[model samples]
Target: MSFLPPWVGLLLALLLFGALAAWVLRRGLARQAANLAQVVTGEDVQAQAHRRIQQQHLADLDRALTEGRLNANQHAAARDELMRQVLLDQAQAGTALQRGGDGVTGPVRWGWIVLLLGALSGLSYLQLGAQQTWWPVPLSQRVQISATSPEQLAEQTRVWQQATQNRPDDAEAWLTLARLQAAQNAHAQAEQALARVLALSPEPDLWIERAQMKALSAGGVYTGEPWQWIENVLREQPRHLNALVLAGSAAWSEKRHAAAQSYWQRALGLVPADSEAAQGLQQALAQAQAASPAAELAQGVAAPPSAAAPGTALAGDARPVIQGEVRLSPELQKHIVTGATLFVYALAEEGSRRPVAIWRSTPTSWPVRFALSDSMGMGAPPVLSSLAQVRLVARISQTGSAQKQAGDLQVELPGVKTGVQGVVLDITGR
Candidate 1:
């Protein structure tokens, strides 16, 4: 059934109740009137019977007087007595009519009864009928389900849609819909649903959930409101596990290695060391440490020495270097943001994934010049001067993170030798 507005339903109820009360009052008054009419008719019938008897007695007295059976005084006295008795009967009938009329037709008696009934009904409604039981609640808002199949999930989604539309105040329903949308990878819709849920009850965990969805919707970049939400959660609950993890991830994405490490370390301490969450956290920390040159310096770890390659000298004075100019292709120039972080590094062609030498800068112009040397080595052996063959790579990170994320422009030149000068690296594509 279509739902009516609360005021409309209330008005309809009042109208129906009034109609019922008026019907009852009218029936009661008609019944009382009928009874009064019966009483008046019975009094009239008794008066007519008395008059007939008196007339018959007077006729018998007149016959007796005319036949000399009784004297004039006797007849006159009997006649007067009969007349007095008739007058008394008439008076009694008039009193009976007056009493019956007053009892049945009085407005005060019926009016008081109607008022009492109305008052009782109103009190009952206030005491018992004013709860949500009488209110029209959407069925979808009250039901809970676990949907395992695609069809069931669709059905569940429709049900929740109806629930949210019909009962906007139901926070739980909105939250359930948000989770369902997130599970389906509909991040935009999920974010919208989470917004409603947050407006209703802004909890830390819910804030984290919303931030995650918003970041996912924006291609895993948390540079806007998503970042703000994560910060809010951390501010409210510093030790919140999910918030800490997400904050660490955001910092890591933005190349804030120290902050990421700090957040993850605090979060790691909160979980069981042998748990899967701890294992994941350990892996992330290891990756962050590997990527961050400052992290290596902070640890004060040195790489083991290795034999130098042909034509490459280990002497600090004759250090092998590769100097290059990084340029964006014409087609990809539009993707580059001003002040974006540019990473120019040399990696060994064969073995380790770590960079032999790395250069980081925020470039404001195209055709940015970059030079990599052993002096910029990430505190490790197999530095730029020792590599026989190296791969030159240049990437621009719009988010300023060293990690390669989606939409970051990059280019790689394999089989490049150290001491190569004026090498051209083009960030031709994403």
Candidate 2:
């Protein structure tokens, strides 16, 4: 009706179409049923009547051939056979019904069967599957895809280059291309990409990365960060290979030889000492050594925090370590050391009859057993998630040259132990 909404009219039309489909299906089923009834009753229908007319025409032709009144040699033979098949087919049809064939009781049409199946599937999905969650659909991928191999990496770099044509200022795209090219060991292409990254006029954070990339690569000193970027990285990750090499290069430029040696040594720890980068490090170390003894001493004396003060050791009484009965968590029994430096380490040997886990403390009853916490400058500590056996020893130094090792103690407990994880203060100042 004109009063109905457009949506209502669409629904009404769909309903009408559905009704027509049902009517057509019912009528086809009724016709099949009637034909099946005739087959069982042995009653001839229009089908059998058509077979009689065909047989009569064939008999007329055969009679003409038998009387030699017509040239029906090939034609009469075919007509005689055809009349005999018609009579046989009629007799069979009257006696028995065809099962699952083109006759009345044939299976439903494949097209209609497929349509019904699809509708049932959709209906079931809406009625049950859509209303209930039978299984969890995970939100994140469980397995991570690794970075591409060298061959694939080269192809991706070309795609990124083309994408940058439409978006010239896309810093992320350029950075990806640069890093990927570097991974593929395409140093020249990487240099070009890095150049574009620097040209984007990025912020200070980005500037550090750009500067590091430019100077760290073999393309030599990039104008990105002339003096500061590599130094900061060195200060944090002194053993970083690229960073160490850059620091050595910068120190050589300033004629600071021993600093170059230290940086090169640190770099050697991360990469082999005989690589091309190492060869450069050797040359710089030699040049810096020739011109930097006084400068090096001054620089060393300048950092009082790290350096042991001249003539003075720790400026105060060594902190005492108090150890008592250990408390076990549901899993572990750990010693509690409050207000003490936890010096975690490994014993040169585990089953010794002496101290294993050590803390930095002054009060020890001994021939001044000096324990240096050698864990400093070590890149990382063990993760807290696992159970591990740790060795510890405490030490106190009174004078710069005179050191006393007093209490070196060890503790063994359940591997899953939790306690204060701290570092010894540079008590050289204290």
Among the numbered candidates, top lDDT falls to: 1
List all candidate RMSDs to the true structure: 19.5, 25.2
Q: On residues 1-430, what C-alpha lDDT tens digit does candidate 1 reach at each position?
A: 4456455665666676677667767776786788789888898788888989999999999999999998999999999999999889898888887787767445755775678568757855854588664555543244344665447777888899899999999988898887666544466788899899878876677888788778766545688998899888778788889888888777765656677778888888999999967876776666556646664566665431332332223333224488778888767777677767887777777543446566777776678887776545432234566567798888788987655566888888999877788899987776
Deviation (Å) of 363 in candidate 1: 27
The lDDT for every candidate, in the order shown, is: 0.72, 0.44
The deviation in Å at residue 160 for candidate 2 is 1.1
Clashes of 1: 0
- State, as a TM-score between 0 and 1, how close model 2 is to the true structure: 0.24
Minimum summed lDDT over a 10-residue window in model 1 is located at: 303-312
TM-score of each predicted structure versus truth: 0.37, 0.24
